[model samples]
Target: MNLRVRVVHCACAGGRHWYADIDDADDPQPDDPFWFVDGCATQTQALETACGELLALSDRVVRGDWLPRVLEDA
Candidate 1:
């Protein structure tokens, strides 16, 4: 599975913040809960958060504690 993480800056409600997008390139899904991280104060923070989340997910998958839906059929 291919995963991609991107940090973005957003301006809304008279405030600015950073966010992260985590995309499973091999299994793109709309409205996936794992797809977004919000309310970060900086791009570095967003990126770090995304990486941490990805690492946690990876650990779960490796330990067989979690199974990705896309991989269920495999």
Candidate 2:
């Protein structure tokens, strides 16, 4: 289960990175684990949202086909 997160950040080009922070990853290399991204945010609200979403993404990645715990279907 590869849960890749596409984050919108300023320093994403070149060798710059903004990615996931999982403890276990596919490729072993010298890279910062971001859930799926990196970079500094200016707004608190956006940062909060990113943090929350990243957590969810992490759960989804590790849990495989497990249903989302944050919501219920009608």
- Candidate number of the best TM-score: 1
RMSD in order of candidates: 5.2, 9.3
Error of 1 at 9 (Å): 0.8
lDDT of 2 by residue, 23-70 (tens): 233546524443333443443444565667667766766777444322
TM-score of 1: 0.68
Where model 2 places Cα greater than 4 Å from the true spot, the runs are 1-42, 65-74
Model 1 segments more than 4 A misplaced = 27-30, 33-35, 65-74
Give the C-alpha miss distance for residue 42 in model 2, angstroms. Answer: 6.3
Reference-based TM-score of each model: 0.68, 0.33
CA error at residue 47 for candidate 1, angstroms = 0.7
**Per-residue C-alpha lDDT of model 1 across residues 37-56, encoded as one tens digit per residue:** 88999899999999998887
